[model samples]
Target: MSVQTFKPSVRVGNWNEDISLDEDLLKDFLEKREKGELLLQKSGRLKKCILQKVELSFSKDGFLHFGDVIMLLNPENSEESLSNPSPIYGNYTVSVNPDESALSSKTQLTAPCGISGISNVKPCARNVFIITSVDGSDYGEPLHYGQNFALRTRDGFMGHLYLTSDQKTFLKCCKKSHLQEVSLTDQPSYETCWQFVYLDPQLRMENEGVPVPANTKLLIVHSKTNRCLAVLRKYILWTFFGKECEVTAHTYLNGHKAEENENHWIIVTGNPSDDINTMFDRPKPPSEEMNENKCIVKPLQK
Candidate 1:
């Protein structure tokens, strides 16, 4: 496979405010330097300055370096810029444009050009499962997999979810092995792997020692992108009821949060009958069966 390269525009700003290095600010800073004024404030100081345009690059080290200063790119907080007091001494939002190349490369385990074996690669699991809504009235449309991965409340069947090896992209009803030439197996060659990441720290603390409810709202993160999965709802005539619903990965913290609906999605799980053994398969124990129920999918509560 060819290594993909991404060059996203990076912006820095205050965490709690919409402050960033605007053209006016940059120009003002230049004027101050020409006047021989001090750049450092008593509390907050301008640590570094950029003069001419320089080539910016990102690596697997998770830091965007320009000259002597470095910005920490925390995967846990993938959507926002973090505060690094040593280099840049304040809260800054280091925003990266969510282009395909940049997104695919960032989520990979190694550099795009590095020689990482397949095992080291984090590919989306290929599994056929149902995305059941929490209200128990609707399901994702399997037939619409090629179109938008639409979901509806009535007359919809189970849709198979698949993830690419990079884990940043998603596909429907496709096997990773089929996407790449590999061996065959009686078991599913691909699986849809997902998890609920807590959005509120206080909510997490409050629910400590208590089992999380099935209806809890979470950011469904794909293992590869470390970003949230969101459904893009638009009008479509081919859907179960002529309404189109599509799923896409989003980086809302990067100032694009308002562009996408972060409030959607509840949980994803297998069909209710997934635990029962078929004629060709052996029955799993209750404990094992319960583990399969973790795929929770539902609409966000109003």
Candidate 2:
């Protein structure tokens, strides 16, 4: 039996208004690539070419700048997203094997909403898709190649990704996110500064004998309520690793030590503070002696 062939669409924001991968668009993209408009890695086991990286600007000039972890694309041939067998009633999830390559390299995929009907999206130009290497005999496709990565069509609009490696990708997909383009001259946006929170296991353990180490960085912001804290953790795990990543909670800040886990990233305090609370709290007022001869703390608490 012949496998079904589907022509991929390159619509700006939808599949229906598809534009054929004409010469003009490819020419423009190639010119931009050579102009250093995109990050280009010269060496790596995986072919390195960043289509785009999340960037923020703090300058008044209106120019933009991107952060690290250049968005690189896989160089493999086209592949399809995993299809579930027993489509009517089945239980399954995408399970990635834990290994260096899978962990080191990741991609995130997003699809347009309001599906008119069942569909298959072809690869976009230079973009990659994640797919199972094996086929399912029962499901009409061969079974048992297991999960793997493959490149999207070179000129297709960004479609579903195989793995995602950063928070920026999640923000792009979340509709409720209050995304705003800050003026270049205004306070630098989240894109400009590296976000890191100091974890001090000793402090947390001092309050409670929990062994959570404070040496690691926790990027997800915590809250006063347990619900919020749990949500933060859940969000972090889902945002980057999803079900594929293994996440551990730390009690202290120790980014310097994790330098070896280059694949791992951290968020820590940017300014100086004796304690994490003070780092997060407002500045303290100066201490002074009152005319009544008693020591007084300025800005008395209400």
Error of 1 at 112 (Å): 26
Encode model 2's per-residue lDDT on 1-302: one tens digit a residue: 99756645333454443344455688877886675443332212123222332121112221111111111111111121134332211111111222232223324212221110011111111222122121121221211111111212111222322221113243433222212111111122222222122233234324232211111222222111111000111121131122321222122223644211111221111113333221112243555433211124465668
Top candidate on TM-score is 1
Q: Please, what is the TM-score per model?
A: 0.26, 0.17
For candidate 1, write residues 109-168 as lDDT tens digits: 111110001110111121111233222223321111111111111111111212222333
lDDT of all the models against the reference?
Answer: 0.26, 0.22
- Which portions of model 1 show Cα errors greater than 4 Å? 1-191, 201-210, 234-237, 254-260, 268-302
TM-score, structure 2 vs. true: 0.17
TM-score of 1: 0.26
